[model samples]
Target: MILVTGATGNIGRSLVGRLAGAGAEVRALTRSAGRATVPAGVGVVEGDLDDPGSLRPALTGVEAIFLLRTGDTDTSQILKTAAEAGIARVVTVSSLLAQTHPDSSVGRTLLRGEQVVRDSGLEWTILRPWEFFSNLLFWAPAIRSDGVVRAPRPGLPSPAIDPRDIASVAASALLEDGHGGKTYPLTGPATLTPQEKIAAISAALGRPLRFEEDPSLATEDPADDLAAAVSFPGVCAVASPGALSTVEDVTGVPATAFRQWAIEHADSFR
Candidate 1:
C-alpha cells in the first residue's frame, strides 16, 4: 500500500486522488481522518508527523510513503519508524529554496529534512518544487473585494509551478521504479511577474484588476520567513534557473501555465 502524508494539503490531496484513480492501494494520513475528504476506496487514518508514535496505525501494511515534512517535525524518528514498519520506498516534497537559499533558516531546515530522508536506508526520491501557483490565492480576497492586488515587487518574475503537477510527479516516483536516489527540481513552463499574473486573473475573470506596489505589505515576521522570501520577489528571482520541463519529462504531460491555472481557479477570485 502507498501512504500519503498531509493528505488534505494541496499536493497531497491531488496525489491521493491520482493514486486512487490509478487503482493503487492508497492510504491517506491526516491529523484528523474525520475531516479529510479523499477519494473512495482510499483508506483514511489519523496520524501526526510531529508525534511519530501516532503513525503506527497508518504505517502498518504500507510499502511506500509520500512524506510531507511539517514544521520542526522529528524527521529522523519518523523515517526510522517507517523503515521499521517495512516501508521500502519514500518520496519527499521539499522546496527549491533548499537549493537556492541555503543560508536562510527555512532553506536549512528543508535541506536537513532531505538529508535525513536520504540517510534513512530506504529508496528515496526528493522533489524540490519552485513557487506554487496557488500562492496567488493570497490575493483572492483582495480581488474579490476590490479587484486589486496590492503587493511588493510587481515586476519580479518566478517560474512558479502548479501543486497538481508536483503531485503527479510524486505519484510517478512512488509507484514506478527507477526513481530511487533521484532529486528533481520542478517548475512551470513560464516565468511570470506579479503584474502578469494579475493580468491573467483579470482575463480569467473577464474584468479589470489593478496591481499596486505596496512595499509595506511585505511580511516582516520571522515565523513566516519562507512566505516573505518567496512572495516579495528578489530572493527567488536571483536564484531561479528559469522554467524546466521536468514535469513533462517525468509525467509525460506538459507543465501547467499560470493563465490556465487562473482560468480554472477564477471562481476563487470572483
Candidate 2:
C-alpha cells in the first residue's frame, strides 16, 4: 500500500487521485477527516507527522510514503517509524531553496527534514520544485477588482512550474522503479518576469492588465511583509533559472508553461 501525507494539499490531492486510479491501495493521512474527500476505495486516516504515535496505525501495511515538510515538527522520528514499519520508499515534496538557501527559515527547515529522510535508511526521492505557477492566484483579487497585478520585488524573473507536473513526477517515483536517491529540480519552460506574467494573464483573460510595483514591501504592514518573505523565494534580483529537464525525464511529459497555466486558471481572476 502507498501512503500520502497532506492529502488535501495542491500536490497531494492530485497525487492521491493518480495513485488510486492506477489501482494502488492508497492511504492518505490528514489531521481532519471532515474535509478529506478522496476516492471510494482509498483509505483516509487521521494522522499527523509531528505525532508519530498517531501515524503508527496508518503506517501499518504501508510500503511507500509521500512526505510533506510541514516545518512545525521534526520528521526524523516519523521517518524512523516508517522505516521500522518496513516502509520501502519515500518521496518528499521539498523546495529548490532547500539546497541553495540556508538563510530562509523555510529553506533551513526543509533542509533538516531532507537530512532526516536521507539518513532513515529508506529508498528516497526528493523533489525540489521552484516557485509554483499557481502562485499567480495571489493576483486574483486585484484582477477581479481593477485588472491590476502588484508585486513588491522588481525585475525578477522566475521559471514557475505547474503543480500537476510535480504530481506527475511524484506518482512516477512512487509506483514505478528506478527513482531512488534522486533529487529533481523542477521548473517551467520559460523564465517570466512579473510584468510578463501579468501580460500572460491579460491575454488569457482578454483584458489589459496593469502591473503595479511595490518595491518597499509595505514596511508599515507587518502581515504584508511576512507574506512577501515566505512566498517570494525565487523572485529576488540574484535568482537563477531552475532546471526543467527533471520533469520530462521522470514523468515522460513536458512541464506546463506559465502561459498555459494562466489560460487554464484565467477564470479564477474573473
Q: What does the lDDT read for residue 258 in candidate 1? A: 88
Using Cα atoms with residue i matched to residue i, what is each candidate's TM-score against the true structure?
0.94, 0.90
For model 2 the local lDDT of residue 225 reads: 34
Instruction: Name the regions of candidate 1 deviating beyond 4 angstroms.
Output: 219-227, 231-238
- Between which residue pairs do clashes occur in model 2? none
Provide the clash count, candidate 2.
Answer: 0
Question: What does candidate 1's lDDT look like per residue over 137-181, in tens digits?
Answer: 888888999997776544456899999999999999998999999
Q: Write model 2 residue lDDT over 139-170, tens digit each, in one string.
A: 78888999966666664667788888898899
Report per-prediction Cα RMSD to one decimal.
2.5, 2.9
Model 2: lowest-lDDT 10 consecutive positions: 218-227
Q: Pick the candidate with the highest TM-score.
A: 1
Query: RMSD of model 2, in Å?
Result: 2.9
